[model samples]
Target: MTATKVAFTDVKWTMLVTLHMRAMDSRQAEPVLGDRFAAEAERRIDYDFGSWRMRVTEGDRHLVTLRAKRLDTWAAEFLAAHPDAVVAHLGCGLDSRWLRLAPPPTVSWFDVDLPEVVALRRELYGDAEGYRMIASSVTDPGWVEHLPTGRPLLVIAEGLLMYLTAPHVAGLLSRLTTRAPAGQVLFDAIAPWVVPTSAMLSPLLGAFRMRWALSDVREVERWGLRHRDTETLLGHHERVPSTLVRSVYGVFARVPPVRDALRAFRFDF
Candidate 1:
């Protein structure tokens, strides 16, 4: 007989990748890291759920997967430009971006997360020549000082901001911007209009053990970072094609009013 295992808060959430990978099935969602990473992520999710208490839905799965893939594409492009730079993935969770991007030998990649997540990452991926895992929350400024200076840096905070309070996120952005001489940050934010609604539904979602902390896109500017550009992801990628967008996203793409309102924004420093 199998013994019951206690659930821990430190375990990386698998629902994060479910949305994007499922969206890939429609052929409308163009995933930056391709299929292998998505498949691996799904496998990890399945493994974790088997051993722990977690819940995911078809919608949640699709959104998380698409968001991750989009961010992966953005991070890959940044790394490609600065081959010798340092790449930091804040709240790294159990992602395999280093494998997907395959940075050159010269590039240094750091995966930052809570201590528990770091332990899990070590257990799963081990260490490599240039890949390092730092067990520290991004809000902690001490980690920034340790990173190598004198080169462009690319910091990625996929699905991180939403979980943070406004002040904490602002503080983190300020610290990162000040520390890196030249670098860009790629992150997602919801518009102000969507936050209240999301918050209202949070309780119901929480009943199922799912909760969301969303951020307003406009609030990012308060961090003193330059606003670059914001792209609406639903049908933005050319590779994804229109048919897949319509089929996978369904009414999400068709409802002009809702599509306009519920869009993700990208910001830079």
Candidate 2:
């Protein structure tokens, strides 16, 4: 495998933390990951050498687990509906969603991310029978042309939107929608207020960097995506306790009603 050209930074570290969180959930769901992945994930947590130290925030961890479960459910349903569907996970990082979903042999899954991230993933997980990895920035429309455009595509952007600016995200969405005639995209978003503040304070959260270039859900609709659903992820998921949600989001919760103006939003498009 080629050495990763991507430098370790807070933004990239955040993805690693999220991936570890999901791997932990997989261990909890089914011992499929067994001791190996779990132990490796634990070691990553222990070393704490990354840009952002992986702190298991109760609410954030809870939300990560809940979202993993929900994504698995959605992937299973999508596979069942379109047995031959093509699923693309944008900015996949080191996530093993394919392993978690275990979609049938007929399902074709593509894990797409930056070249460096993809290189690191290949070293860590390698490719499977029906799974492939594309090393390219999501903003590049060229990658979409390589996918099986004939089949319906289920595109997933988990915890990726907030990092990109609105125009770049909008362009990516437009390209995907146009490239794949009919498809659904599931992604998470935060209110406009959270974007600027998070961007400013991101450096403090370890090397876990964040940049919020987008604000409105309506802007996504402008790119030809229809809003399908919005749900509070952590506590509302039932999997996570309300207390945990309050604890994790409590900082945000403490924000005066004026600050409440900065609530996050999840959209299915």
Candidate 3:
């Protein structure tokens, strides 16, 4: 059946991409994340995703789960120290991350996203105590106001930041760094110079042209947060898929210029 119940708008439509990626991961021979909850959530969506062709090879598949898997790993580590840490999942799609990551019982997790996206997520996943679905853009100055205070916080931005304007992203970075003061943040992106041509090459991002892209990981240091990695997050993983991607990444990672095809950074304030 075709989707007629709702139409995804602007950045909200991007959520389906992550949902589809997770669904694809579940079907892999050796799934990276193995998020069964993601597969189930994809099933519950009435939207028809039969024609979207983003991941065309095993290499693409490995990259998809790598972003998510890294974020999940970081979350686990943060929660291990501060079992009651507040997790802010910005631009959270139909990810079921709280369900998949399974943070501690005392952990406070917030799924912050667009109004339409949050509404859809509520329908798909329902409401749970300590887990919230905040309906607002991550750029909002007051977005930080909704999160719990006086607790260790970990902000997971996953595929966000790039789509926003420079000022918007700057404002958000300032807000996050100031509001939380001390915590971790996980966000991934290609360099600004590359992002202009990225959409043309990747069929998935072809339609949605991102608004802003930063060229360097060090740029974020201006926001008072330290960039944790110089290399791409995909390369440092323990269990990289034994595909041509590994070979390509192995060689490309040797270079200083082209190594950061997709840069992942964890920030410490």
Candidate 4:
């Protein structure tokens, strides 16, 4: 008997972008977020990572891992405050974030993604005691109803929002803040300049179609969230441990205007 291979199609194929990055990080001499599971899992699947060069370039190959590292840091801090937190990792791909984070046994972790992606996840990793594999689109209103109420909830959307409409992201924030007593949301987004045109045509963006771009994450503060924190992610000075990538991106960061071109933002309510 042989194991079934992962077959994510259409928009679901976008998940591979992150998958490729993790696999590459594992191969790095100094992996920023060296996800071991990603390396092992990538081997099991027949996905041709070598051919994905059009998308994950030499520099971007490093940036994707950095984004994951920062998001993981934020998630860890949130869990520290609410050990029994309810986490919804929207657009959860093949990356082993839940297992790596290893939240306290009391925490309830939900890995949410499209039905196809969810099926693949269950097939590969199955489910843990407090872990749930949710098969549904993140934009679906019904998904929110399934979450436990009156608990500290942390919603993580990595490499997800830019693929969705602006209204959808806003609606999601509104839902989470209103549904959970204490809540936090962490996500990454493209800068505005890259949004309207340049990024959509960039070879690096590849299969990803940028629908929303926020050069300044503070602009999203107008979405009506009472509290928010935004940080420069791709900029050289911020958390980018790779000296090579820092030197490359640091040039743009020095421009000041490109400070938050690509960023990770956290909103608390």
Question: On a 0 to 1 TM-score scale, where does candidate 4 land against the true structure?
Answer: 0.89
Clashes of 1: 6
Candidate 4 clashes between residue pairs 3 or more apart in a chain or in different chains: 192-215
In terms of lDDT, model 4 sits at: 0.77
Flag the better candidate by lDDT, 2 or 3: 3
In model 2, residue pairs whose N, Cα or C atoms come closer than 3 Å (at least 3 residues apart or on different chains), thus clashing, are 10-207, 10-208, 10-209, 11-209, 51-207, 52-207
Ranking by lDDT: 4, 3, 2, 1
lDDT of 1 by residue, 1-269 (tens): 22223133322443233423442443434443354654544444324442223343443444555566677777777778888988878888767778877899899899998887677667657899988999997888888877787778788887676666677877887877777777787876554455556556543244222123333445667776666656555554333434554465665656654544434555666
Candidate lDDT values, in order: 0.62, 0.64, 0.74, 0.77
lDDT of 4 by residue, 73-109 (tens): 9999999999989999998988799987999989989
Which residues of candidate 4, in runs, are more than 4 Å off? 1-3, 7-9, 52-58, 198-206, 215-219, 236-243
| Residue 212's lDDT in candidate 2 | 52
Candidate 1's TM-score reads: 0.76
Candidate 3: where are CA atoms >4 Å away? Answer: 1-6, 52-59, 199-206, 234-245, 255-257
lDDT of 1 at 13: 44
Please give the clash total of every predicted structure, in order: 6, 6, 0, 1
lDDT (Cα, 0-100) at 159 in candidate 4: 86
In Å, residue 77's CA in model 4 sits off its true spot by: 0.5
